[model samples]
Structures are given as C-alpha cells and as structure tokens.
Target: MKDHVKKILDELLARFDCLRGCEKEIVTAYQLMEECYTHGGKVLICGNGGSQADADHIVGELMKGFLLKRPVSREYATQLGRDFEDGAYLAANLQGALPAISLGNHNALLTAFSNDVAPDMGFAQQVFGYGKKGDVLIGLTTSGNSGNVVNAAKIAKSLGVSVVSITGAGGGKIAALSDSAIQLPATETYLVQELTLPVYHALCAMIETHFFACS
Candidate 1:
C-alpha cells in the first residue's frame, strides 16, 4: 500500500513539474483572458474531438469558482455580519462572471454553416458574426491543422480578436494563423490532448484569480 501511494505521488509530481515548464505560456494566456474581461470582451473557444471537450472544460472553469474560497464584498459582509458563513455564496455571486462562448456548443449553427457555406468555414462563420475587436479567440487542435479552426483563426485575426492556439508541437495552419500559441511537447495526438486539458484548466483558474483580485 505504501509503495502504491508513493508511485502515485511521484506521477502526480511529475505532471505538476511538466505544468511548471509551461508556466510562461499559461501566464500569457491568463493575461490575455484578463485583458478581455477588463475590456468587456468574451472568450471564444473552438476545436474538434477531444480538443473540443477541452474547450468546453476551460469555459466551465472560468464561468464558476475553482478551488479558492470565494470572496465577499463589503456590502455583503456588512449585511451578513457575523453570520457570514453564507458569505461564500455572496462572494461567488459577487465576482462578476466573465463572458465566454464555446463555438463547439452550437450544433445547429455549426451544421448549417458547414452544410451551406463549407465545412472549413463553420467556426469561421461564427467568428465573423460574433467576434469583435479585443475579444480572445482560442483555437485548439491536436494536430494544429483542423480546417475549421484554421479558418476561425483567420477570421479572428481579420476581426482584430487576439488569436491564441493550443496545439501539439509543429502545429500547422492554425499555429500559422494565431497571434500566440501554446504548443505541447508531445507529438502523439492523444498525448497532446491529455496534456492540453490541465494546462487550460490552470489558465482558467489563473485568469479567474487575477480577475477576482483586481475587481
């Protein structure tokens, strides 16, 4: 039992170490997210398959509180006084929700765009309609070459949204279109997807923390 526990701990530590190595990229993403929130812009995320799941997961974390204890505003604290054990709810609600939209969530629109316009233009068309200057468009692709994501990145660039891409090393067209990119060292698609999940989770947590601290 002791040996098993030790092995698990070691693996967890290694994963954390890997995360630390990607610290700069994560910080950059956090800063971008903060800027968008401060300027009243939304985060638009899109991807395919497992990367699509990653996009939605990131939005989920940012839309709600993570592990940190929620913070209460002075108004709530004054009203609740010593009975502020319920302050967590007030704090959670007080922290304004950052706007985020997962492009992968709209199946009907996506299918319509894909069928009528072009498969590659599905995400791009959405961007053309919804994206604005100063918004952040996050494109996720294990291969970094999904046609839809690449087109979306291009549309984002044209609309002046800062494009950020999370992809495997040697990311192709999507990387080329992005303003900045977080490239996982893994070459295998599955490994890249596995690695991307936690990185974006950390990014979301960091962004929320920064927003809470500043606002």
Candidate 2:
C-alpha cells in the first residue's frame, strides 16, 4: 500500500513538472482570462476527443467556485434576505455566470457545417458566429495538428479574438495559429492529454481566485 501511494504521488508530481517549460504561456492564459472578466468578454473553448472533454471540464470549473467562496450579490441579498441557502447565494450572486461556451457541443450544427462546408470548418463556423473582438478562444489539440482547431484559431485571429492553444511540444500548426501557445513536454497523445487536464484545472482555479472570490 505504501509503495502504491508513493508511485501515484510520484507520477502526479512528474506530470506537474512537465508544466514548468510552459509556465509563461500558462500565466499568459491566466492574464487573458482576467482581462476577459474585467472587460465582460466571454471565453470559448473547443477541441476534439479527449481534448473536447478537457475543454468542457475547464469550462465547468470556471462556471463554479473551485476553492474560494463566492458570496451572494447585494441585489440578491436584498431580495432573499440573509438566510438564503448556498444554491440561492449562487443564484443571487450570479456566481459562475461568466459566459463560457464549449463549441464541442451542438452536434447538429457541427454535423451540418461539416456536411455542407468542410469538416474542418465545423468549429471555425461556430467561432465565426459566436466569437467577438476581445474575447478569448482556447483551442486544445494533443498533436496540435487538428485542422478544425487550427482553422478555428485562424478565424478567431481574423475576428480579433485572443487565441490560446494547448498542444504537444512538437508545436504543430496550432502553435503558429494561436496568439499564445502552451506546449506540453510529453510526446505521446495520451500523455499530452493527461498532462493537459491539470494544466487547465490550475488555470480555472486561478481565474476563480483572481476574479470571483468576493462576488
């Protein structure tokens, strides 16, 4: 049992160590999130397969309190009095309401766009419709070579949205397309995806602590 626990801890520590190389990019992404919150801009995240799951997971963490406590807003305090439950506090405070959308959803629209236009245009189409200037678009690709994610970054750039990409260390097309590229040191797709999960969770926790703690 002791050996098993130590092995797991060592693996986790190693995974975190992989992030040291991309620490600057991670900080840049945090800054982008802070900017978006300050300016009332939204964040849009998209990816494929495991990357898609990562996108949704990051959004989920951002849409709710991670570690800090978010209080009820004055408006809600007045309406609900002082004894409202945690759910009411969240509803009143408008906690986790920072307008983030995962483009990986909406399969109907995605399939239609892929069928009519090009498959690679599915995510890009969504970005064209939903993205705006000053918004943040985060694209995740293990290999950094997904055409859809790359084109979405291109569209995001054309539309003046700040683009952040999380990809493997080889630096695929997404690295060139994005404004800030966070490259993981791992080469294998599964390892890259595994490393990406905590990187995004850390960013989400940082954003929450930085912007939404006081409500």
Candidate 3:
C-alpha cells in the first residue's frame, strides 16, 4: 500500500477512532481494486438515494483525474494524430482513466426495469449485462442490506466477479455476500456516508498516484 493511502486511513481513524477495526478490510479493498485495474478490469458501482450519489461521485473521480494529472499516453497521442484534425488538442487534453460505471445513474433502464420487470433487479440486470470474471462490484448501503445493491452483488458473485460492500455497523446481509466488506462503526445513515466519502477518495487517490504520479 502507498504511504499516503495508509496516511489517509490513519487520519480517518484519528478523527473517528471507532472505525479502527475496519482498517484491515479497507486495505483488502484497495488491494483487490489495484489488482483489478492493473489487469484491465473495470469497476461497477451501485447504491440507492444518497448512496447513489456516492456511486456517481466515485465514477466521476475514477473516469478522469482525481488527485493527479493523468495525461494521455504518447502512443494514444500519436494514434489520434493520424485520425483527426484536432488530434493534438484532443490527445493533450484527454486523461488516462480507470474504467467505471455507476449502475444507479441510468434513468431509462432503471425505469424500464421498474415498470416492466422486477424493480429490485435494475442494478442486477446491469450487472448481468456488464459484469465479467475478475471485475469488481462495489455495493453501498448504510444498512448493509439494500435489496437492489444486494441483488447486483449476488449476480456479480455468480458470474465470478468480486464484491466489496460498504455499510454501517452491523455488516448486514450484504456483508455476508461480499468478498470485502467495510463496515464502519455508525448506525445513522448520514454518519456512515460521511465516513465513506473519505475512504473511497483515498482509494481513488492511491490508484491515481500509482499510475499517473510517476508518469
């Protein structure tokens, strides 16, 4: 693990010591994500309500620069030059991205599923369509048991995908289904979300730093 990543975890512990017990799980999540991305696997995230927002936020950070300036590679720059008039401009501005998809953000598909088929399986349907072996599904639910997120995780697992569940105190049903579960010490939904933000941000930074900082 990178020092700064560990540093972020330590700082979070300092601010909320009750989360001290979750350190090991958090590290495991980081390691899994690193291996996934290193091997060209993408991440699929799902949640509800505020957690949905969190999912979108994570995708935003991962699909572009978060803590580092992830300039496009020279190879890509050259390829773009041969294809378009504004190739140099496009290449210069484009950033290397870690592929990610927020399963909660598609309104059309979600509404269609809810209206025509099983409402709780919207995320699961997306997972079935997009997930592959070696990819990861990050499910966020303060109660550790959001139905849709849980279903998506279950489907993901069935397809040989790994699951990382982020939740509050009990590490509920979703935790049991997850390969890595980060159960923070808080019962209130808002409080759990507050803690989740920093944790994922640290993860994004760690990954970004790993590839982009030295480049």
Error of 2 at 56 (Å): 1.0
Which TM-score value belongs to model 1?
0.79
Expressed as tens digits, the lDDT of each residue in 1-215 for candidate 2 is 22332343345447687566676777777778778878999999999999998888887887766766666576765666545556465465555556789999989999998888899999999999999899999999988999999999999999999999998997798888777798989879999998888778767766776676556
Candidate with top TM-score is 3
lDDT of 3 by residue, 23-71 (tens): 9888888877888898999999999999999999999999999877988
Per-residue error (Å), model 2, residue 9: 18
Winning candidate number (lDDT): 3
Candidate 1 achieves a global lDDT of: 0.77
Q: Candidate 2 or 3, higher TM-score?
A: 3
Per-candidate count of clashing residue pairs (backbone under 3 Å): 0, 0, 0
> Using TM-score as the measure, what is the rank order of every candidate, best first?
3, 2, 1
Q: Per lDDT, what order, best first?
A: 3, 2, 1
What's the lDDT for all of these models? Answer: 0.77, 0.81, 0.90
Estimated TM-score for each candidate: 0.79, 0.85, 0.95
lDDT per residue for candidate 1 within 1-215, as digits (tens), equals 22332343345437766544454555566667778888999999999988888888888777666645445567766676556778556555664466888899999998987788788898898899999999999999988888889999999999999888998888677777776778877879999988887677666666666666444
* Residue 56 miss distance in model 1 (angstroms): 1.0
